[model samples]
Target: MSTGKEELEVEEDFPVVDQDEVVEPPAEVAKTNLAKRRTIDALLAEKRLQKELEDYPYDL
Candidate 1:
């Protein structure tokens, strides 16, 4: 039963947020997060390599 004009009017009632206005974490927090991410990435890479090696054992 709602019309298109009514939907458009409803959408205008909310305020829009600008990306620049968003707040960022403090430098120390950002650094900690980055370190944690790197550790996780390294662990994932190690696991993948181990799996690949197991799949194809080498004779030396």
Candidate 2:
């Protein structure tokens, strides 16, 4: 039971959609992302240390 209606064929419309396929980020993106994460981790660690230092003698 096949009516060969060309317009209904998926392959005909595939090329247009395929052309917009996602491309992986360039190497620089990985480097920058790593640096960004390191910077954030360092910042959070510093904040925690500062908060700890603030309660040196324990405000009891």
lDDT of 2 by residue, 1-60 (tens): 668765663555544456469686766678898999999999999999999999799767
Return the clash pairs for model 2, or none: none
1-60, model 1: which lDDT tens digit per residue? 767566453545778889999998866678898999999999999999999989895776
User: Where does the lowest 10-residue lDDT sum fall in candidate 1?
Assistant: 3-12
Residue 37 CA error for candidate 1 (Å)?
Answer: 0.1
Which structure among the candidates has the greatest TM-score? 2
* TM-score, per-candidate, Cα-based: 0.48, 0.49
